[model samples]
Target: MKAATATILVLATFTLLSSGKKFRWCTLSDLEQRKCAELSKALLAVLPLATINSFARVSCIRAQNTHDCIDKIRVNKADAVSLDAGDVYSAVKLYGLTVVAKEIYEEGNCVFAVAIARRGTLDIQRLRGVRSCHNGARWTSGWNIPLGFLLARNELLWDEDQPLSQVISQYFNASCIPGVGITSPQLCALCQGPKSYVRNKNHFCETSSSEPFYDSEGAFRCLKNGVADVAFLDHLTIMNGTDSDQEEYELLCPDGSTAKLSAYGTCNLGRGPGRAIISRHNFQKITKKFLTLIQHLFGQNGKERAKFELFTSVPFRGKNLLFRDATQHLQLLKDKAEISHILGLDYVALLKGLGHEGSSLDNSVVRWCCISNAELRKCEEWALNIKSDPLVCVQAASMTNCIELIKSNEADAATLDATHAYIAGICGLVSVAAECYGEGCAPAAGRTKKLTHLADKALPPVYAVALAKKNARHVNIHNLRGRRSCHSHLYSPGGWLLLSRYTVGALENNTVNCDIGSAYQSYFWKGCMPGADKNLCKVCIGGGEMEGAKVSSRCAANHNERYYGNMGALRCLVGSPSGRSFGDVAFLEHHNLLKNIESLQSSGWAMGYTLNDFELLCLDGRRVAVTDWADCNLGPVPPNIVMTRPVTTTKIYGFLMKSQETLETNLDSKFHLFHSQKYGESDLLFKDATQYLVHTSHLDYQSILGDPFFQLAESVFNCTHADILEFCKQDICTS
Candidate 1:
């Protein structure tokens, strides 16, 4: 009767405590319920004794496990709870909870996670059909560390559409995973129902201590008793559990190194940062004050340490409550950002690995990125020749989109024009290979000996040229103002840079408009500059967009544009009827016009256009014949460079180097590997006039293009407010 009265009195006291005024501390449910009660009792005795400026009364709340406690904190049902490193990641990402305090242990503030097996019984790669034991799903020492590495190597299959827990169950023959949901029977197949709930069979695999193999010690015992062939647990648990018989177990490192359990710190997969006390981001100050007060009274040198051994001993009969066994005290963390830095990037990778399963990008394939349907067709042929073992083409909407794909680990490499290369370099991509152009009408056979690696040779500059009809109304370069013009794309060196330079130089003395993008929009009467802003695209005939694509002229950026690439720009110069058909002048590379003009001028050609009618726009403002291009063309432009992210550069270099060897050796084939013929276009991946691919290592934007040219490109593009210049507001390469 006296015990019942005391319990009633405590219940009434808790009922009077408002959530806003008191800290609701959460602990693991059931057996840990008494531990929660004990922590509350310690806080009651310690709050008055500590010298903290702000006093916070702490109350205890029981939750199913660490995740449940996190959910409680997220919903304001509880204020804080100490959790494992893996659980802290979930709480931070899923609920935006912040780490207020970290638990300090005697052995170390951190512990390594390892895979253990009976000596000579298992290896990391040969565990396909073996029974497994885990401390729990998403645990740092058990699941995330070891499993994250396996998933990265594709040793285990992964399917993101299905439950990650279900995928794990399918990988192992049978497994005991405590705290995993019972929605999938495969997860619960090997579980022996806990003794506490014999009638509820499904509750056997729960995270509570009632389950046979639920925690670090439980998982080790499961392996010891022959319930599982391999067990995932912490180094501390393995060292303590196997101390009685050293020869009974050995640690399995992914590198195939095996050693006694004591060497686990060195032989383990990875070390997880120690458990942390987390709270809602807003309640950090109050949470820190309450924990500091409790740590002072129950810490190693506390005066009232006898009331509750908060750090020295496990609270009550449970192994952990607000603090773990052998913990010295709690250390306050500044903020969530500091907590992320303490956890480190590799530990964050392990948490991310939990969500990824057998993704195709986790392979050795050199994913060649394409930005258009036309380029994709050519990429498909390249994929077929390589047979897709180590090389495959992945497509995105634009070059900028392709760079983003590399950042996200989706695509690997792409052949980018110099303009795109500058943008890619700003995004931290490295130049792995460059298209080497020499004096050749086509790639010469038996010239494989001259093909040097990217490091040995530099790409020859290609000249930019402006073309116009010999008998056009606007006769020369000086007459470009108020006349119709055409361009490949806004960023193309030939189409935009050369023309932009002339426009700015011609009107430099005028102060009406300093903005180049706006100036070009108003300068040209009506033009088909494929990728320009809406005003520049008003005269575009709308054939550039993909079928079923949105009805917007700005979408005419890639091959879909009537005047897109060098070839597309040349085709635009070959006029059509209906008045809006063609521009009076076209800007493109010198070689692109040479390859297509002879054919377009032939009566046999479908367009009925003649090269005889076109003339070159010279620097002296005079029109010249096609044969006099060497004397009339604009500045020499930088060549295309094969680029990939720095992380994947080496792997892609090896793959591309070998593919280039095969293509050069078989250069005389009816279907040329270096050139594309699908849409009567010769160059898609490499220039049709490209003699070979030059191997380059450790080459950057400023190095390959030269500092002066890079600055010139930067300045020229800056005139029109290029995205690359904006992205390079600071030196992203050095940063």
Candidate 2:
């Protein structure tokens, strides 16, 4: 009778003490559930000491998988669950769950995914027919990060209409991606299932341990057994899996180089976010507080660690039971933190590319911005012809206006010169592709050879040259202090920036503060600089004036200014139909130097001038033939780039690539992507010399423009109180 009374009194006291909120933790498997139950018992023992107003009771809820846990949390059946970074993306994006805490490892809240292969057996660049091993389907370190890196580098091309698995299966000879099952048999070819397939059941590609090659360790074992060429796993797994013969295996870097297994910090595919604990949106605060309290009691440095270990799964005989064993502690996140902030913009973009959030490539019409009517007409014609991937033409008055339009989302993309590309990047736009000229897209071996490889293969840099008539013997590069000059535009890379850097910025007599415009005005005689004011516009001949009429098009930077672009500047030095040349020297790009001279000869503007009539003024005070621009040019200019809003970069690149592929395959198509002859113009929508467009999404404006040019641009534009810089600054502030 006395014992029964004590038991009843204890039960009543327990019911009264546990009157706080309850935290229901969702578990994926039976082992995880058992771990959770132990955790609950440990929390109960510390409830009096660690009690918080938010949560004082702990409960365990079982789910079949991560997706089921996500659903259970959404319906209020569970309060929280720990998930991998890749699964966290789906939970936040698809289910609208909130991340309350993150698992911080020894390397902080991120892990590096590395590619391992036998030394000298594989290269990252040559993975076409190589056998590959992955941790699991849609896993962060194994499947997503490495494959996403490949797609970003243009090594893999995927059509959004089909599953990404199909593309992966076709790209590799064989792969072992457990959980993918028969959907991609090629991906399951190397996975080892249970010994008894018919009697014990077929677990060929299960995500569970039934499949021998399932997680990071299994994937590495697949490589160790000589069945795979490369194994994609996390750095921790690689470190744990290697033995005394670890020197025999090497890491495959994204740059096509190999490194020792210990160089994972620098040689890896990508840095991925750490696993996180997620909860329903309304349960975030409670979950965060509860997690903080429990972690303090049973974490790595827990005060009550003698009673319970929260991070380990040794007793459960499992790996990563409730949380990753590698987790150092649980980091509570700020209320405003989102998945994108945790996963980072590039990784979020990669997940989107994998069709997790949505299809990166959409059917929406891409709006291509055109600054002039000629370009608009050409764009409309191209759009009409390429009906499969639709394009809408958006007209703007100038390149600056096009930048504003694209920033405001009114326009999708526009091709801009190197100078304008810099301004666009400053205005929050990104480069997706760049124009490739000459024989190919690869950098030429030497200046004498236009291209060592075929055109359409890579992007070749354009050369800037100073052109002068061969008949002018008195005027040379050294004595051009007071000579009339013609420039493509105010801040054009080849025409103005490079030319002024070597002249006004170099000469002791012409050196002023970093004011390039003031230096140009004081150094050069009356000349046409298009966008400059006063004496700079004195030699400009408007489009109407070129036809022997007077108009306001004089000094305008567009086509209205007859002497505005490379060809226009060439026309300024080549003389009019009446044999009256306005400028003594012209600064332009060398790619179209011969072509522009030929076009001028055919148009009767340079009746007496042949290719030999013009010569290049070398910076060393020596004159050479125009064909010798390889050694006599001002500097090598980067090719024009296609700029767009950050969100539409991949989409616009896909549209343009598809359009180019269509034009290449259809020989009888009337539209010409590079040529502007049909429009009675030269370089309308794109440069007339542009052979093709190469994907440059991996590079930024600073990288695309090269270090020397970028530095020169900063000195020329940022140093001066120029109107373009002021406008860009204002745009940035407003944006």
Candidate 3:
């Protein structure tokens, strides 16, 4: 059984390696690129050892640095690259790369930051004047790990008035830290520069092998050639670069004990994270196959272990590339989630401690808002339009999710109805803009001018009218019993709210229940009230014939609900299922009557209905024209308001306000920004009737909804129990 397992592993490796696919590996230097090409050929040759197989190809791409490699991968220009802990942090957070494989060493997957010195030349403590050699500044092993430990242990005193590099330089008599430039001269004070400070020269301070005293091997070379007393490097470098016969180098253990190079793991200054092979998050399937094949051929017990030395041997002499010199094997990583698992939290924190200045953190991009599946298409279009200038993006879910998104900093702004706006205010989100109807009741020149044409301002309330077939004389205000009805969602002001007030207040002698939803459900035989409990969806045929989950799903509050918003309710009124479940009346906004008449042919549900087919039910007990809503409408409600988090900066506000200007000034014929029909037949992220977005910066929730209207909406929202006067107040503000 075990033999079969081993054979299967080997055969799988050979088969995948011979697939003839090109795997591009990113490298920093030409030498490394050449080495990667050689390694690729060697890896391909291993498949033939067991039997003939396909030849897998490897291509090397050159990048300026570790960060540049991540950028290349993000745009799909390159496939994969190896990165240190700091670079891995940037890759995951900024470019969304997945860590596919980890480079394992002899002792374990990780190597430690170790300090090496000639015997008796350096002490664990009280050696402030000793000279030092480092691989480079900003490196995990050479700088952050060791220096951070010393500062934490109080062995090194930090001077607040001076740069950290200056303090470190003052502590050592002379030091050679490659990559430290003239910005901090103290850091470059002891660097012995070559004639031109170029490659293939001695004593040039650079991160690459071009400098004699660069990288881990170069730092140790500074000590070997008697230029510096002590060198800071990883255990792998000290062991790989030193001779077996040489007794000059010793590791400085944290316990103040000197040990042989073999004992460096326990005697190290601090443990450092290993390098990771990263690819785009979406390329996991292919990357996994590639990683598995490489591990099988070059692993500790592979057929070509000696001849190719894919993992154990250095492919190039001058530089590190493709894989590090001492890496024993490549171990597969489960996901990007393993980044924090492989690199301990302390080490990860050490990398993030660099702060957000000039790092991968981008604060300039503006995050737009979205809620539910209905708005996804429109939000994505908006995101694409402002992709460059003051870049905008959208991410939010349902109305409830949008409130949470604002609180969690995931989204910046959303446009909502009066009821939803009030809920957002209670949740601590404030209204930033109000929807202007452009009815010409107020002038359009000033920013803070009073909106005269807007309804539900504590003046005359926006009307909510009931619609029924013109010939349905049997249904009336007093005898509306056991009739199929349609509503614009459960919480909508025009639908559920107005009807609740009528049933619980005006018909007090007949209405018994105080729970408005329960009362409505019992009053109507069966109805389509999206966002209602399951019992309310009993009669929904889901476009008159579909059954089971389809009908059930069509009863939700979001776009999935077939009979959800204003247009959906109108569709329900005109919709009939071959003499089966058709709504007798529809409770919706008065203006929707006109929209329904115009869309009779394009909208499938209103197929047989005409402009004169529907009539409005008046409180005066008369059926009137759909245009006679002014006298028959229930009451006025507030318009939708755009809301956002209470941000201290004007960045988000400026983005939305600018978008408002572009949308209003240049309304595209195919795509109206404010009344966006791009997503569906109904209004999407913003209301369809919206003429423009008006800035209401200084207005609070009370001011936006008007004081009288705020009180009315609050009473309806707080109505939890049964009492004719308590459930339905007569003074429910007319507006």
Candidate 4:
């Protein structure tokens, strides 16, 4: 039986060697190479026991470091390599490599990165100038996870343009982070070099075992020896290396509290993925097959372990040489599993915060949110032509969704009308800039003329006018309770909320509990208030009678509805060529009322509409010329403001201000920052009559909206009664 086994082993080894199929494992140091060489021989010796066909012989490939190994694997120079979770993030993200298998320790396929400190020696909140120890420069538990936690929690202030090591050196008094090198010597101040080194005169911060404080065990040792106040390492390392009194050590959690070592699961910096075997994306299948075969042969219960152990580095006189010594088996990941799924979103976000994986932390590019396809097209054109700052366009289903997107960091900024701006502010957003009109910051005169700029002048507030057709003799503001009304949108400052407050609430005293939407639904006979679901949506012309129009988009609180904005409300009163006018009065801002009418004359829907065709319905129940809006208007309306998260207010304002200046001076430029007529839409992003953007970073929502408009907003959104505002507050609390 022994002779037959020997014959089969010889045949299998000869077949694998002669087939020229090889699995090259990348090694970072001489020690890892020697261990990999032993693993290769062991795999060859047990080849006959593996069930996989077309077996490949194992070979060791030497590389300078983990990043070099990743590059080699990317270009097909190496087949596979075992990497810590941090390097795995880099390998998969920067190189597009895929994980084939992960080393399963007693903690399963994940490990918790914890900060270990002697009892009463450290406080997580006051870590500045404290001596620290890390496993390695970019290792998972040591550098990335722990520092990333600090960065995320605002404990570390990184400019992202500089190296994170410089920030770390300035933060901690000294650290033993192996492989950080001479750029920051304080990082390697606590490292102990090899006791018996043959060469490499400078081994203080070497990545290999030559540096005594190079990994989890070394970091723990540094803390245990009273050299470092705190040691960042994995829970497994603390559990395995803690031979002294258990009560002497504790875990420094990110929440500024300390817990016993056994409570690491909840008190650690962050949970990280285990070490994984990575290969080229195309080589994943073969890599999985090869790993499965090898693990089955030399794993814990393998028949050939008596000859060569797979998970141990004691014989090689090193710790975690080729693979972690604590690994019990290899767990093959699903073929379709992505790197983000393996590392988890929280850890991935932490890495992103540190600028280690995925998109960099550069804030130069501003992502603008668009709520419609037409707006997206105009935004794309703006992104392409803007010269001062880079722009990227992100789309949302509605303006409220855009607000949520900006809050969640998925989007950066968006242009919102006064009402939506109020909602955005309630949801933790701030106004960064406000749209300014023509010369003297007044409304634009005409569409063809160039907009003039006056830097020192304050932007003029808009006027809310109740517009009506000159032919409608019986449609005065006082007798419009049973007549159809066209409003810009639901909860609009000028068209709906304030209009209701002054007209229905003041005149009739019928605004019960500040329910403006309910009041409007009961007052108006039938109309188009974009977000309303009652008779108000009955008159909305969704998609404007075009072919293949979506009926579901009717009364949508976005550009999808024909009567959705100031211009849209005007269109509702003007009517389409194929359809008659649907409303008796159109309430909207008077900023671009005449310009909108002139632009509508050129469209197929309202070919004959002109400035003289409409008149304003005054609050005194008198009808007057549309040009008398200053005296015959309902109230003053605030300008549309650009909203962004509070943290990104300055960045977003800078980008917008630069873009506004750049686009305003380039007369020969085809792309206009405020023009949306060429895109077959009006006011797609910013209002078409906007002259420039005024920086409002110093102003809050109330300041930007002005005292009168803000007071009206408070009355309209009384928290407990206003359903939209209540929902927004609930969302904020939950989120």
Candidate 5:
């Protein structure tokens, strides 16, 4: 009888104590559970002395595991509970949840929601009637937080130890009680702790018109259903929108009918709040550093505050597991200015070839920097491969620095250009498979054109931002002002034709050539740090980005040694003082072809250097007339050193396909031309006769075109070495 009477006394005290207008929870929910557990002995330092019994059990739930506590609360076993925000619907269709409004706990990770609806979907006058159908209610992250916020607004309190019926009666208007309906009690009960719940529908609720609806999601649905004249709420929904559902919402903010949004209001206010707590023992033993770290970590700015839900799947804490909802590719799109890119290697060439045909390809490609030599072999085998899309690899690189260059706009667009894709691969980024200019291009600075390996069908054109042509006409000249002009340094068609022309045109043909080298070097080390660590692999050095310069310098460094040859930067021909000549460098190097051909033009001088680079010296104007040199014989007569040399156009292009190979066979081909030849060695090598002519296969011309042994003429051109080589050989030699 004394125990029963004691219980009655306890209950009576709680009732009378909670009846007044003030209700500040002395004890919170989630924290109380740990204190009750014997396992948390040392950690539960909050235990009060003097036999203080906490009759008011906090109903707070820190996580789903706290549902057991919520169950105890529902059966009158405990006082109140706390929960996080996961129980809400955050999908495309944001739903409305009718929950108790009490602000118990808030933090960066989770916040207690007061209420939410699609933007502009709620009416202020109609907010009182929602959830009139529930007997008792369930809770979510801050069902209690919101309750506290609102009840505090009206300066009311729930009668303590009283049924919720009696508690709510004191706070709510008499008429509002009969109309109260809860969001989802069943789901709320089932989702015990900090889980989220969607109140409205499968899709997010839309605000229509200028009125505040009681239940955000449902109010919007009600507005759409025409039950209400206007709907207004929060959740970053459109303050103004043009979409179908957007038309239904008309914003109602501060100052009643005024259209402007004074504050983000409920949308911005209910965000998670931060608090400082540690193990009770730790709290008593707080170090300044620990407090500082916590303050820094939970601060109101930076990535920690971003609170990206789906992005947090992988905790970035050295866990080797990757979690992504990759089931739907298109659904991942966000309404932000972001671009998804594709980056890889030589494979980008294939993507680009496809783009040249006016087909839709990837939006962009990195560069020909990602393909490994081994991958090149695989590419050869998968020449016609439709399964291994280069863009897919490019997409993978978009995840990091591996993606080299990227197009400016669009958050989720796919990059299709192979060159761009390869650059992405080198940088380690990811993007979707794009069918852009880089799509069909090889990851390497491979074929500017398509390959016979792939099938005939051309790739589709990639879509990109299109500006008015009229605007382009006036602004075309300003394009390079602040742009980074780039190209391979060693001579090639791309380097020569486009880059050289641009350089020569910009800087003009200068004698010192200082500006010319400066311009090209700008591309070399501008983005590169001085004494740049060789972060890039040689395999990525096709067409001599840095390799061409390095090779020339190293070889020039050692000239007298047995194997010490000269400039590997070019192919050359030695011209004798007697006006006779013989091939010096291998045909593949072709520097000599460009070097001294013009020496024989007007004066026929055994000149030291012919600095006139690919100038249109001899032109009929009908087409371009050049001294052809690819496959044609060094034409007729007694080896006149200054006479225009002949070459083969078609065969040279074919040879180019085989020229850059590092194989011994290709090496033999470079020397075979010098070896099988019949010539007086000294006439070309020196003014004297009979030197090393009768020895091994024609004095390996590769060695003869020494860095300093240039007895002929040399010149620089405004075309990539490949282009100049192909242009002169095809146009001049094919004749």
Candidate 6:
């Protein structure tokens, strides 16, 4: 494993660093490429605002992977190479290199190297004794080894220290010169498309190695024509297709959202040693220059990337899952010429069998569909009736057109299924209807007449309210008076109203919290989108299906920074990352008691306080809920955020502590969907699950369980110890 013979002369060809030009990192796709474009926008903005031309140029560079990028970098081409996180370490190791700048683009090593070949050689599976082409011997030291990989895959490895054409002759296998590179051909392949690869390469083959394919264009062409079933490519490469060429991609960069590639990082760096960089000086300069564009990283400039983070994380870690606010930090990196996040997403996915796709986050690329069958049927049916000569053109699969239909009042709403409802609802659309199972609504009941586009609707047990910030006003938040308030139901009507003032104020002050400034969910759940409306909802959760959970609507704008999804975010604020560890006094205060109730009662609302200080409220002829719980402090090392709430007490009862770990365990699939989570239960939700917790001390749920949802909880409540056995009666009932 030898390196370059001499210390490489460091020269930056990018005008951003030398020609006094800008730095650009381009890509294609809605997530990665969009993120790069967004970040680039911010860097561009930073120069004029800060009055600094530190970066001669700032732009996105589009390449296949790290190797190609490093090669380009070696030629003093691109200032910095943007690769995924996990592979960065590996590529550095493989290429035996170091880092200049880093940013956590994606969270994991999802990228895999695939061997590709002409259709005749499609069986190029485990290239054992068969001819194989790869970057040469010297490069394979820390990277890919054709022979070894073949052995593992149960194939033949016919590796030889030679160029690709020669290896093809001797061993019917060949290797690209180690570090000699494949980029040139990759580009050519893209232009010719896949058709040419088959006719040209004759018997082409590739080794699953790393990224920045010198010949990505070539490989793309090979795969396109079916010449190659698969290719040694990065995850992003497969996702974005290709820019067609350089200048064309640059045009798309400024166009928005279309420029992203893969979401997570890839791992195929040809199994390199370690990566090296030009020198620390260049690294420092790049870092310092990028740090100034606080807005790009944290602001609207990088929205596409933020959208990816939001979408991927929701399924990865359920809705109530917690994570530290990365907004501010990301915003800080905007201005510089080139910035990257080396460390990646540390959180792992809690995969749920989520969609039409299986519970395979790895094999699947989640796409939130904006239209559903029922809705599409309705649109077509109505299209027949309209008879107007307006352009009825649809981008076909365009979410933009779908969103515009609702926003511009051209259409009443957009519709989709439950699993996909999240996509429409997340950024900014209402899920007026609930998430429902797929119902083949192919043939409409009223074929001749236009009908409301509603599918197999989940019984509307719970509903969401969505609104755009620019449209609505009257947002508010309680003074809180330094009191820690655990405000759950972030987008709930009551929750939104309560937090409005604070959210609006935050936006006024330039904080990202209210970036959208007091928007509503309008039957939408999971999360919110940027420019959505209520009319977009077409999810039809028709009446009773699976039992909905027993939840209470409580309000107060509290604990924004404290909890995520429902988990703790930071250990503490105003200190080192770990400085604000839980203090010992949180329990003794029992802040959950009458403290807030007393304050509320003092203000006028009357309620009967009960054991554990539970309080029930009577507003207008119906009973409302109000309960108190202790706020967290540092005492006892491990602190339990005392539980007390009016709505559903069973879930949060019994020692649910004030730590992120506890939240994860409780909200886990087994314990959630509104089931009891026990005190001191370990990570697993199965063993020692808590049963029968107090819903509310003051109001016996059985008294007036008027709501159908309450009726179900009541039904379960009526069940006795005998009933429990009967319900679970695994006994063979042979009658």
**Top-scoring candidate (TM-score):** 2
Candidate 5 runs further than 4 Å off? 1-40, 43-62, 65-409, 414-419, 427-493, 496-519, 522-735
Better of 3 and 6 by TM-score: 3
Residue 470 alpha-carbon offset, candidate 3, angstroms:
1.2
Model 5's alpha-carbon lDDT is 0.24
Q: Between candidates 4 and 6, name the one with more favorable TM-score.
A: 4
Off by over 4 Å in 3: 1-363, 387-397, 441-461, 506-512, 541-552, 576-580, 664-669, 721-735
| C-alpha root-mean-square deviation, each candidate | 12.8, 10.0, 18.0, 11.2, 29.1, 25.1
Runs with alpha carbons beyond 4 Å of true place in candidate 6:
1-78, 83-97, 101-107, 115-148, 151-220, 236-282, 288-295, 298-735
Query: How much lDDT does candidate 4 score?
Result: 0.76
lDDT of 3 by residue, 434-501 (tens): 76653542335655333223334432235688888898987766566678888877667778766766
Q: Would you estimate the TM-scores of all the predictions?
A: 0.56, 0.66, 0.46, 0.56, 0.19, 0.26
TM-score of 3: 0.46
TM-score of 2: 0.66
Tell me the deviation in Å of residue 229 in model 4: 1.9
lDDT of 1: 0.67
Clashing pairs in 3: 18-54, 372-397, 461-636, 461-735, 462-636, 462-637
> What Cα-based lDDT does every candidate model obtain?
0.67, 0.76, 0.64, 0.76, 0.24, 0.26
Per-residue lDDT of candidate 1, residues 1-735 (tens digit):
955754454343343343337668886656566766666665565543431222235567776556677888999999988877877877787678888877776555676788889999988778877898888777878788777556544565554446667777778888887877767566556667554444333347776566768778778888888999998988766555546546888988766768888887678876677677889988887677666555555678765788877663343555544566656667777764554355654355345435522334455466778877777888776766653245677877666677666654578788787778888777656777777776742345644533355453456788888988777846688878887778877777777765666765423525544566677778888777877775566556554323333455343767655456776667666654333457778888876566677656442223555667778999898888887878888777788888865444555666776676665566564445566655455467677767666666445666787665587666655445666444434321110
Q: For all candidates, what are the clash counts?
A: 8, 7, 6, 1, 178, 143
Give the per-residue Cα lDDT of candidate 1 at 580. 40
- Global lDDT of model 2: 0.76
Model 5 per-residue lDDT tens digits across residues 606-667: 44344332212111211111234222221111110100000111111222223212222333
